[model samples]
Target: MTEGGRRTAEPLPTEMELLADLSRLYKIQPATALWRAVEIREVLKAGLPTGRGLDLGCGDGALTGMILRYAGERPELDGLDYDHGEVRVAERRGVYRRTFCSGSEDMPLEDSSVDFVFSNSVLEHLTHLDATIAECARIIRPGGNLIATVPAPAFQTLLKAQGRTGAAREAYVTTMNARLAHKNYLDAAGWAALLSKHGFAGCSATPYFNRAQVERWEKLSAMTAGVLQKLGATNALLYRMQRLTRSDDRSAGGLLETNRGIARWSRHWARIVAGGVLDNPGTDDRYGCLLVSARKP
Candidate 1:
């Protein structure tokens, strides 16, 4: 165990493995798919003369690479994560100019040093979320932007309702919370409040959840698996069942619809399955995630 009392039995993986895993999961070319709609490109296009940025919780440095490529000048980029194995992997991939093993609440970089700070699906994992937000405020130069995404609370609560009882429920909660230290799913109002408390200016958020898209994906995966099963494909059945079971499988009637109805108004279902869901456009009513952008005041 390390000094923090957490187990250290597993060493961090090299960057190659991290890239390989992401490539498989996203089912697209690396670098391209990972940063596609998160707007890292557009944000960089605005141009930071200083060419310095930080990628917090940069799992495998996928975003880190995109940031570097977008900057186009080999700007001073840093990537940090609590997992040393993942950091090592990033280092091996040549993704970040500098890579370190660090946590959200305790970044190693100096305060007010970076021109920009970006995190994708990262902030929610922090146990000390407020402290980390304060740290993000501190480290970013005045007027620098902090762009991030967080799971919408309504969808999470809906998942919880379906999760009802047993180990499955416990596992669901544990996984959701672990993803971003998501103490609770933050609605737009909740997110704006957090940003304002941290002295962030002009805080804006976009809802990105799509219940219909998620339902479609689930249905398609199920159908594909069924077809394979009919052809005597045992592995296909197992895979399809795994996906279906993992999805929020509660019927769309009674209590579940009521929960979804609440979710609709709160805009708590925006998600980043691969990247931003720009192809599907509708009001915030259908979104399940929140993409929040703010600046240090």
Candidate 2:
């Protein structure tokens, strides 16, 4: 698969394939999440959760299903979501053996019941982040891991802020934060400290989503889901798109023509959109996301 140590002329990375796959089911979602699934997969290559895993903040179970499917790892999973409405939808996917509808600050689970808690891009949005972290600490068995991914410092300084300065820059950051429902950006150090304070041990964070990718995602987002998001139609759109996936499952032969066409275009879209910046980000001076993990102790 490699002429040299580098992957110069090999098949396109799984990330591209994943991007296309997500395009089918999550067309209305920000494309950034599709890009993130692969990076998260890469980050967790060291060790994925095993035995009694929990999908903390699992939305509709779609993203979690795609991520785990690509990772080729399927452990019995439980899901928890703040919205009872969303949890109802997630329960139908059968990805999670059990689903709980509850707030993160007060999860409904027995103490020390799960082996690992996997939260993807969820912690930063929690208003009671400390309390939620404490709950994660409490529910995870001793030595179990809390694996999460959150925005990094570069999220505030996205390449979109290239020309802005002074007050303008601050305003742009504020607007971006408000759009994302984020209170503050937390780099690897901040997350490590928080996990440690919550009695987690050997905390480590790996940064991903390089600057160029974030910029590309921003552009793709405007073309894909930006308008729906602006019109507050995201939930309704998600319902419709999710129906297509469910319908495909019940069909006899294969994916419907609609889904097939979407899949093809999505693959082509991946090719063009990722043409220049498709290289794997081995290291970066700047990145937009952090993959943080720590063991409860």
Candidate 3:
């Protein structure tokens, strides 16, 4: 990953291209998807006061914009990412008041300065889980919130199992071995324990999935792994299966509704078993991600 104050020769994709591709693939207007992410942030911080917030690993600042929108008034918001290219894109978009190119393993922020620290689909990519958690604890004020989401381990394991190649297998295995590597999926107990170790309290994990989305993914998975395999499209099959099984954070209803909140909570606990916990509890046949929320004490 590129560090702050450094430039690289690798040409980065234009923000417009990225947004257009994402919009086309997700079947939604780019602006609508962007605003929805903000709405989710508002729901996550429902009880907290509108104050200064930090977005850790804020890729392209989409979530940063969401945070500002959800706050109603433009509360002080800063975004940080390890990729200098992404930081540059965020700056160009004017989504964040301040965008820093820094890794989550080592955030350059003052202690107890921010009221809330939010991350989405970012903890999975860190190379230093403990250090990142410690940094979060160090930067957040007392009683401040830390909201994050990560792919569930079971989902990642399934993806690895579907990959069919020596190199692809190796890459998958490497990711699985490192807790801070790609798609670092942690169980409920593990997340709670990490929060406690880092001076956080009331740590909880909520599982999220969309019935309609999962159903569509299941169909896609069958076509890729089943039909495509017979057609001698090994690489294409793997690609489709991987894409079908990959984590989608937005599918979990974004914001919880009264009737659906209980089901989502149950699914979150189910992920504990999926993450390698011995005791198999809760009932959610297919879980893709988990949301963890805690408070600095």
Candidate 4:
């Protein structure tokens, strides 16, 4: 239930840099920015193993692009995702040397061709963990690593603990889990044992986003998005305004860019203020997410 040891490869990004990176998400989806930006800090702290690597289950590739911006070293990066639409968006971002739209059970890569594999918050949705882990082990050279993040059991526990009973409680839990098609919610030890069965040893899981923060994210995301959508601003004026706030020249690549912006300046300001709360890196065993990594030996 412990947070993992601090990685010493390089100092983590400053609070200022975090806010700036977060600003990008804030403009896009003000409600979720707090949680997501904080997660980005964890990814930065973990620091990718240096060498050619694959970003398994890469979505729009935005997070991987952000990771590269801070990670002083550049590795040959390839990406794979089951969603072809997201694969197209990832390609436009230019974060991956190549992008493939393929299922996790079967990757379109030569066996033993990769140095490492990384994924962020993507494994829990898949039903075939064993097949996917085997595919990862098959493609990665011996001694390489598989690093990913998923909802810990505490995530579901926290959801259920929110005080409902009977069919109402079951419906709530089912609805939430259904959104992600979550097939697993294992603790670190459970994850370690699962990985060991598939030949991935030395597994470790570090918890992040304690209960208070998780609750905050859940509440704020629904509140903000719901309010905006009701007002019909999510896809109209708000969307246009968010586009204008972009500091970069690249075009916004996905449906989310047009569909998810929170137009109100108040939400943006609130996010900057919440940065402090989200960045605390609190110590709590009942965490919302777990960052898990294991070696294929």
Candidate 5:
């Protein structure tokens, strides 16, 4: 992963800078996509491929374009995602040479077509990770790189459930996972094993986004999404209501982004963390996320 999180030749980005970039083009008032900037910066420092590459799970192609521009490398790239609407948006952006609207587990592409693949914060939410990883192994050429940013097991510990101990923390972790739609939160060794099982070798996982940074994101999430999760058992009515009422899936940025007041406040929050460092104090064993890298064998 770069030698260390903060030890790079490039200037460390402030929270406002990231927020501005995300919010700019009518996006985040400093949305949770701050996480994307965190992952992208570290990935850039680690050196990504600039040849035939794939942006796996690319959403709207905006973030992928941002990462490439930031890195000063314009690799010939193709994007893949399941959402037809999103794939249309990505196609309109002119970012990818080719775009596929398909699920990760069953991608529509040639074998060994790309030298490298980059996925940002996409793998953890998959219910079928093995299938997706196996597909990645198939598409990337031998010795080609597969780089991704994913949630680490430490992610649960880094949440705002700080003072809670034992079962309380465990419950919070479980509830948060349900609310966040996260299925896998593997550590370095677990990820290496999974990659190896799918014909990937030389796997390395570098955890990033330290405690304070993640806590800030969590607090922001809590304020916006609330503490209560709509886990279907008891809140079935509310869940059903939400499913019926929430039609803003096609909105820019997010569902809340369409709200005037919410957009204003979100922008305000984006500016509050002016000099917030992306990876402060550097990534340690306790960091919340991982930048995993591997090679097709």
Candidate 6:
């Protein structure tokens, strides 16, 4: 049985295998990559139909590669990202049939052309949320699905509930907003309504990365990155190490032997354990992240 208590028709990648794939991105941001891998695994477990799918805001294309690994085959996928450097790296990864450097607010594709589309942690960063979702609705054909994982509004709630008050709360909010660069945060109902307004139907959302798990990620990420910086190690150095050592599925073990690798491994293990307990199937309505889906109608 899967973590959700549902029988898997085919097993998802072993945690190690998923980590190995994420090692491609761990070089970029170790803590973020590891935690996002958790959310990606949960989203892919839904087993959506894949054909000529587009990965909107596909940073480094690593998450899309993880989806392909989960499906056990490629499915005529293409990726889009606004960062020129990230797009170049994604092309080098060669996971997608093509990679484009363009904002999600305006896709270059024709309307009613794609089978499905998905994004991971992308929509929250865009200021023009309506324009972007409209573009997503425009490109997908009738009956095609838009599956994305986004930061839910409960993140803000949990942040406020941290017992800070007065100037402390203000400072915390300011720091988090600056650090996260999120332009949009909404609950499931808000997302469903937005999608419905843009020609989608059957909008549904499931929560993941509950409050406790999110807190762990924040604490562990700060601790790990802080230690690495104090030791004069940078994400650049870790990326180089990963590039040199990551040839296949065994990369996680190889990295675990080093100090930086240990930091990453610690974060990964903490995430897995915390997620298993807090974000398991049939959790409460509040979540740090929302895995949402809608169909073009």
> What TM-score would each prediction reach against the true structure?
0.59, 0.81, 0.58, 0.80, 0.81, 0.77
Worst 10 residues of 4 by lDDT: 1-10
Backbone atom clashes (below 3 Å) for every candidate: 20, 0, 2, 0, 0, 0
Q: Once superposed on the true structure, which residue ranges of model 5 sit more than 4 Å away at CA?
A: 1-16, 25-31, 227-268, 274-279, 282-285
- Per-residue error for 256 in candidate 4, Å, reads 9.3
Please report how far candidate 5 places residue 5 from its true position, in Å: 14
TM-score, predicted candidate 5 vs. hidden true structure: 0.81
Clashes of 5: 0
RMSD of each: 15.5, 5.4, 14.6, 5.2, 4.9, 5.4
Off by over 4 Å in 6: 1-9, 13-24, 27-30, 160-163, 224-285
Whole-model lDDT, model 3: 0.56
Model 3 TM-score is 0.58
lDDT of 3 at 158: 41
Clashing pairs in 6: none
Q: Per-residue lDDT of 52-116 in model 2, one digit per residue for the tens? A: 98999998787787666644345789999987656877877788999999999998999999999
lDDT of each: 0.56, 0.71, 0.56, 0.73, 0.72, 0.70
lDDT of 5: 0.72
TM-score of 4: 0.80
lDDT tens string, model 1, 243-297?
2321122221123223445334223222333333334454436555666778786
Q: Report lDDT (Cα) of residue 278, candidate 5.
A: 54
Global Cα lDDT for candidate 2 = 0.71
- Rank by TM-score (best first): 2, 5, 4, 6, 1, 3
Residue-wise C-alpha lDDT for candidate 3, range 1-297, written one tens digit per residue? 221211233333322223333332223122223223322432333422347888888766754553344233455678898876567667766767788898787788898989988787778777688899999999999989898877566554444235456788766445433422364568888899888998899987766533332333333344434454456656444434333321232222223223355334433432221232112223555555576789887
**What's the true lDDT of residue 28 in model 1?**
20
Model 4: per-residue lDDT, tens digit, 43-158? 77777887889999997687788778777566789999997656877897799999999999999999999999998878888888879988998998999998887888887766
